[model samples]
Target: MGLYDIIFYLFAIITIASAVVVVNSKNIVHAAFSMLLTFFGVSGIYVLLGADFLAVVQIMVYVGGILILLLFGVMLTNKIVSVDIRSGSIQVIPAIIALGAFAAILFSIMTSTNWKSESFEIPTTTSVELGNLLMSQYVLIFELLAILLLVAMIGAASIARRDKE
Candidate 1:
């Protein structure tokens, strides 16, 4: 096959594998690491789709920033590391039936939907376009988001710190 096809399949396999690991892994830290890999694989897929800005942002925010914070939170907050948490039942019949029905619905939707590509897409620098939109059309939203992140960071820091009293 072609080079792109090979790369796509490799990334797709890693993505699915990491996702399964993220859900199935017993070790909390290892599960977090697997989740980061899954996020990175998805970003690689975005890059393969020619959405470079989205890919970069996904890697930076989801993998680099959010995942680190989540990992740290797990390590700092939890007293115990590996525990056998009873999540679900051993009955596989219901789960298999649900998965089969969902798959059928998704397959039918995919077969019926004919996706169309735009002939002339306006190509603009994503950062510049985002900045322009943030300043003009969505200034308040941008400011609010910045404030929210700041608040979250401060709150997390406070929670993680040892109490002086």
Candidate 2:
């Protein structure tokens, strides 16, 4: 295999392993940390896929922002560590059925989609292009995302504070 394949496989393995632990781990903190590893591994794989921008975005948004928020949730919600972090007698069968149905739909969509392959000459400057595109075409989307994050932070803080009273 090539360097890309090696790196991709390594990252994929880390991502899957961490993701499994993220869902199954007994400690909430460990689960949060495993999610962090999963996000980092996925971001690394994105970089290997020749999407530097997407990789940076995955790290920044998922790892830096979302994972931190998740960690905060885990920390703030639980005052003391419980013996069994995971709930017992969970409805796994229904979840599996739902996921299987969703997966089938996704597979069908993937098979049906006529994806276009674009060939592009490498531009000397991409950062400027991307910035310009975001500003000119998607500034509203950026503003909306900022507002969403602000709202989430405020809501989480309010909920956390409510426990005090």
Work out the TM-score per prediction: 0.72, 0.73
- Model 2: pairs clashing at backbone N, Cα or C within 3 Å: none
- lDDT scores of the candidates, listed in order: 0.82, 0.81
Candidate 2 wrongly placed segments (more than 4 Å): 81-86, 108-114, 118-125, 151-160, 163-165
Q: RMSD, each candidate, Å? A: 3.7, 3.2
Model 1 residue pairs with clashes: none
Write model 2 residue lDDT over 67-93, tens digit each, in one string.
888777766666555545443447879
- Model 2 residue 74 distance off true place after TM-score fit, in angstroms: 1.6
Give me the candidate number with maximum lDDT: 1
State the weakest 10-residue window (summed lDDT) of model 1. Answer: 80-89
* Residue 143 lDDT in candidate 2: 95
State the RMSD for candidate 2: 3.2
* Per-residue lDDT over 69-117 for candidate 1, one digit per residue giving the tens place of the 0 to 100 score: 8877776566655454323336568877998899999999998999786
Error of 1 at 119 (Å): 5.7
Regions of model 1 farther than 4 Å from truth: 80-93, 119-125, 154-165
